[model samples]
Target: MNKFEIFTNELLKWNKTHKLTNYNEDEIKKQIEDSLYPLEKIKDSKTAIDIGTGAGFPGLILAIAMPNTKWYLVEPLKKRYSFLNYIKTILNLKNVEVIRDRVEKANLPKVDLITSRAVMKTNDILKIIKPFLKKDSTILLYKGSNVLDELQDIDASIISRGNRNYLFIKGEKWAK
Candidate 1:
């Protein structure tokens, strides 16, 4: 079995008890697809951070995809934080750093990219990530149908796949 197979099995086992996620195997597979769909639009980053990496939606998945990039997965909740760390160790992912704290308290350095999935509103995320962004940084937010409402006053590029909205915002566009 591959790493993702192991990841799915572990997630399923933990979900039964800790309820790390409400998604089943098939649903989680769809989420993995949704998480990776925006890779084409993202810039190659040396370091990246994922806020509220609950059940490792895009963080762990992206870490697996982009092993060359350093990834920090932040989760305030204990169960999910444990899961992320466990996955990191099990997968032998040297590029992964599991942070057991809220994004605001993590006090991480500026990174080349920041990602979040269903974490918060676009503007709210910008505020939190302002300190962890470089001028050429990029942000990839996985949002739902209400993404348009969230982006009403925010400048971002959007791509829709099913009901998922991939919001892409360049640091230069948002940092100003």
Candidate 2:
């Protein structure tokens, strides 16, 4: 089966009970494509932290695509984390680790890449992930079209493509 089919099948199995995502096939395709756009920035990253990974949008997809990199999926909900673990086991994904805790509570190791989808407002997310991001880390936040206007007041460099937004808001220690 193709990757999309496999992804859908796995996601459907989780969605039967968890309401993971409402995206249809085309939407799912778009999400997956958008999730991968940051690969170029995080290519050399040894580890990545995915905050608020509900049902693993960019996290799981990125973990699957980049088997060589370590992925940490940080979610606060117990049931969601359970489902994420189940998916990891079912898919035999070794590089992915699901952390059942909020971004604030989780003991995050320094990572080169930090990513999230539908987690929080652009400004809020920068605060949420401030602790885990390293000096030169790149944050890839997947957002809808509404993000362009949201980026205006934010104190960070941002790139918007279609409905996706990549935030270059490095840790405070880094000189941007």
Candidate 3:
């Protein structure tokens, strides 16, 4: 099996014990596809962070796919943190690190990109990651059909990519 397949198998196995994912097998497959859609946009980024990385949707998968980019998977829960670290070791993923603290509490350096899925609304997410973003940093949010409505009030330029979207807003654009 490929690395993704192996990762999925392990995820499912862990799911049975920890209820890690809300997706079924088919849904999980689709989620993987959705998770990878932002790869092209984030390809040039030197550093990225996945906030609230529950079950490692785009973070772990992205780390596996892009070995050269440094990735930080921030998950506050102990169980999830342990699971991510376990997978990181199992896959021998050297590009990723697991942060066991909330985004606000973690002492993280500014990154080129920030990503999240099923975490929070667009505005809320933007607010949460603002302090950790640099001038040119990009935020990729994996959202559903309500993406348009979610971004309606936000000032950022939204670029649609399949089921995912990128919010291009500089630090100054953020409403304080």
Best by lDDT: 1
Error of 2 at 100 (Å): 0.9
Best by TM-score: 1
Q: Write the per-residue lDDT of candidate 2 for residues 61-146, one digit (tens) a residue.
A: 88888888999999888877887898788788899999988888899788888888888887787777777777778777777777
What's the TM-score of every candidate structure?
A: 0.96, 0.84, 0.88
Show pairs that collide, candidate 2.
Answer: none
Q: Which residue runs of candidate 1 sit more than 4 Å off their true CA positions?
A: none
Off by over 4 Å in 3: 157-172
lDDT for 155 in candidate 1 is 79
Better of 1 and 2 by lDDT: 1
- How many angstroms is residue 164 displaced in model 1 relative to the true structure, after the best TM-score fit? 0.2
Each prediction's Cα RMSD?
A: 1.3, 2.6, 2.3
Off by over 4 Å in 2: 2-4, 152-155, 172-176
Residue lDDT tens for model 1, 1-176:
98888999999999999999899999988888888888866647889999999998898998998999999999999999999999999999999998988898897988889999998898899988888888899999999999988877677888998899888898876553
Q: Model 2 Cα RMSD, Å?
A: 2.6
Query: Once model 2 is optimally superposed onto the true structure by TM-score, how far is the C-alpha of residue 64 displaced, in angstroms?
Result: 1.0
lDDT of each: 0.89, 0.78, 0.82
TM-score-wise, the better of 1 and 2 is 1
The residue pairs that clash in candidate 1, if any, are none
